[model samples]
Target: MNPTKNSKRKTGRVFDPDATFLSNHPRLSIMILLFLYTVFLIVPSLLYTLFVTPIFYATHLYLLHIINFFSVAILWSIIVPLVLGLPNKREFIEYAKDIKIARIKPVLRSIGLGIITAFITLTCMLFANFLSSLLTGGQVQFVPQLLIHPGTTNIYTSLLLGIWEEVAFRGVMLVLILKIRSKRFSIISNGLLFGAFHSVNILSGFLGAILFGVEYNREHFIPVLFQIVYTAMLGTFLAYMFVKTKMLLPCIIAHYLIDALNTLVILNTEQLNWAYFCFMTFVGIGFLPMIINIPLVRSFSFWFPEPDDEIIPFFDTFLVRKQRLKQYKSDIRSA
Candidate 1:
């Protein structure tokens, strides 16, 4: 049965049946999005383990990183749009707007916010490390890594990841959820899914360890679990940022900065213990952002968009008044 027959609205933009169907069946859309994303990540990782790593080994391992860069770009930047049925520029532009990457003003504001978040996250991390050192009687060591010090490949990878991940999680997935649910639900679900998505990395890591004949212990497993938890928290925070700011740029910037900074800063953990790791991962990087987001979520002054608010294409317009739109559609059906 054609579901799009009665789904028309006077929004005066392109009417895509696929988009309509996805909108109508939010669970199906989310599943498709997650399925596509997971397949790309897992397949490539397996390919790398089975093919690339054996050949590259150690010296040429940088090749895998380069491949990863192109793979992510292709998946999120190219394949996703095609899957969403955006076959042309105009349709793609509208999709971009839905993802909160269209307008310049909000993007600029996003950049500022991204910088602030990065600063706050880094400060918390450093402070956590210092406290860890103090309690454990370990000397705090600060080392600044340069872009070209070891190689520029990792730097590029970090930046590429920052952009593409936001595009996928916040831009695509979060927007999809927002279309069908409350803002709070969207942010929380997006964050949780985003964190769960990273669980694929644990599998990849295990495969790598197996390939190398290395014994995987709880030390490795536990850290990966911690990573998943912290990333979930971080994802939720980023989701909140995307919802509040209505732009993807800030999240991209923040994601990139945090990854890049973590890579560049080599903290000394010789005298530190699990307490340090737990505090830094759970409290500093995780809960801190969530704590910061609480106040913004509570503020209801400009919470939902009015009917007359300048429509920024799909996401914001449809999301802010989703209930009202449902009623409007119901009224139309009755009429």
Candidate 2:
């Protein structure tokens, strides 16, 4: 079937089918996108776990960190784009063009925002640690991590991750979702999938993803830096940077800085406990808009005695309006 020709408008729900790229074959588009991302992630992981790790273990030629770097670059960046871009060469070419650092204005803005977020993150960490220490009667102690691995491991790995992860998640996966579904669907799916992709820090990842989506929507998805502090999380900050600048440089730099900061911190049980609590708090705050977004949630909407306005009506556009008009006309004809 000619999916485009047969595309039908959607109404009465968060997901509007008609506004999507492949509205008539939503399922197929979703399957393809998921399959591509899955293959990219799985192939690299398998190659590392099965081949590279064993070779490193036996020969000790290269370290685990190097292996991880190559694996992520190959699977996440090199392989995924090559494999996915093959059939849709022209589309990818255009995507490559659109995905870049745009200009001086947004780049400066994003970098500043990233620095602020880093400071905020640091403050959050110290505050949480102090509160935890108080509760634990000053039992907390910073156990220095043995620098057994290569000293440059975190630096290189973080740099690689910042670059490739943005390329993979924001450049490739998010674009794929936007093409297949409405902006809301794309942002939500992109955010959730991005979180799931990390898997190491699922809650933080999820919160970061949602914040990224919200920022993109807030900016009207025009790739503009509309706000200074979009979302406080490092990952979300990266995503917002991408949206504003349309360039990966700011995102990569910010992302690397955030992860690189991790090298400076010491790990402890009490700190983790308080950090987790804080993480939950941030996520809860991010989702608070849902009180008005979802009518059901508004039933007992906590802070807002009167929910001010709709959360994200950004998805509504001329295309959706036209589709709705067509549907209205069709309904009258049927009657």
Best by TM-score: 1
Candidate 1 local lDDT, 1-335, one digit each (tens):
55695464223233345565555555676678777776776676567767654546466656666666677778776666655542222255456666767643533454666787887787777777777777776656645555433344245668666988898889887876666567877789888988888777777668768778888777677777777888888899889877776767778888888877764444566542677778777656888756865464336315334322233455556555766988999999999
* Superposition TM-score, candidate 1 onto the true structure: 0.76
Q: Can you tell me which runs of candidate 2 are displaced by over 4 Å?
A: 1-62, 86-93, 101-110, 137-153, 180-185, 200-237, 270-335
Model 1 steric clash pairs: none
C-alpha positional error of residue 297 in candidate 1 after TM-score superposition, expressed in Å: 9.3
lDDT of 2 by residue, 65-179 (tens): 5655666666544444345442123232333443442222333544664455445554555454556555555443443352233443355556666667777666655555444
> What does candidate 2 score on TM?
0.52
TM-score of each prediction: 0.76, 0.52
| Best by the lDDT measure | 1
